[model samples]
Target chain A: MYVILVYDIGQKRVGKMLKLCRRYLHWVQNSVFEGEITEVKLKELVYEAKRIMDEDQDSLILFKNRDAKWMDKQIIGQERSPTDQFL
Target chain B: MYVILVYDIGQKRVGKMLKLCRRYLHWVQNSVFEGEITEVKLKELVYEAKRIMDEDQDSLILFKNRDAKWMDKQIIGQERSPTDQFL
Candidate 1:
């Protein structure tokens, strides 16, 4: 699936979350990541993300589409940390 | 269309961006928002967002789908803001 993951983590744990997510998805900007991955890999990413997050304070939301083609993306202003390589 | 918007703004201008986005979309997490909107409204949002952003330093991305059903959303940990009203 193609997933767009947005995370809001406590300051202390955010670096770890960023590192973990970078291994599986493209970091498009602050607190946002997206890319295509298999089901198993998605599960693995979630498992690791959960371990890094504090359930009481942090939040991670994943928007999944069967494929990237199902959605349209637009960017205004700068394209920080571009993910065009994934395209 | 259903849109998921994420933004990275300079600290000085972020508050304004947040306030503006809140008027047109549901705040789902820090710097992340989503909701259903008409094409014209979406264009208006882009216009306003551009006015508040610095092209060299700020970035805003919009992921648009024909409808919300085309994507699946999963939340882990605390949901900083609930957007069930839009659903």
Candidate 2:
């Protein structure tokens, strides 16, 4: 599945979460990450994310799509980092 | 349906997109706007967004969920803004 992950975490924990996510997916934007992964990998990412986050303080939103073609994307301004080399 | 909209637009056009989105949903975070919207309203939002965006430069990603319950959200750090008063 293709997953879009975004998170709002404390300054102290942001680094950890970033590292955790980067290890599993592409860091497309600040506080945002996405890419394709197996069900098992997704679960593993969530588990690791849960362990790294302060549940009461940080918030994470994950959107899963069967494939990227199902999504309609529009790009207008300055392009930051590319979505992903593989995507 | 519930929609989660995120955009990476140019500085000049972002303001316009923000205004268009704020008129319909809550501005939860930078570049992220989301809320419950009807199919008609969703189309309206998309139409307006397309007009405001620089098709070649900006990127918009919309995630639709029938309901928030289908999502697993995790919060870890400082909360910037409430998701929405009603949600």
Candidate 3:
């Protein structure tokens, strides 16, 4: 499944959430992550998220798509160029 | 339909995109907006978005859900309490 995760958390907790997400997905933008993962991973991610969350001061939204093709994604600006070291 | 709009653009253009989205949806978090909008209004929003976008330096993504109930939203932390100026 393709999952889009967006989070609104306290400023102090930002780093922790970002690190947790980066462990499982690519960092697309500020507090927003999208990528493919299995149902099991999704559950694991959610579990970890719940553990870290304040439960009373944060919001986390996940939009799941059965397939990436079903979603139309548009990029308008210049993205960071891939590192030439890999090339 | 419930629409989720997310964007990544130049720092200089952030204000314009934020303003444009604020006109149609609630500002839920940084670079994220969500609300219910009609198909016609969606088109209008897209058209206006195209006009403001740099096309080569920004990215705008819209996720459309047929219904809000289909999506699971979780809030983990404290949200702003509604103010009652009258009360």
DockQ values, each candidate: 0.89, 0.32, 0.38
Q: What are the runs in model 3 whose C-alpha is more than 4 Å off? A: A80-87, B9-15, B38-40, B50-57, B64-72, B78-87
User: Model 3 chain A: which ten-residue window has the lowest total lDDT?
Assistant: A78-87
TM-score for chain B of each model, two decimals: 0.95, 0.88, 0.84
Q: What TM-score does each of the candidates earn?
A: 0.95, 0.65, 0.71
Q: Model 2 clash tally?
A: 20
TM-scores for chain A over all candidates: 0.94, 0.89, 0.87
Each candidate's interface RMSD (Å, one decimal) is 0.7, 4.4, 3.2
Give candidate 3's whole-model lDDT: 0.71
lDDT of 1 by residue, B1-87 (tens): 999999989999999999999999999998999999999999999999999999898999999989888899899999888556334
lDDT string for model 3 (A1-87, tens) is: 777788888888888899999888766666788788788998898899888888787877777766655555544454332211110
Worst 10 residues of 2 chain B by lDDT: B69-78
Model 3 chain B scores worst on lDDT over the 10 consecutive residues at B78-87
Which candidate model has the greater lDDT, 1 or 2? 1
Screening candidate 1 with a backbone cut-off below 3 angstroms (N, C-alpha, C), the clashing residue pairs are none
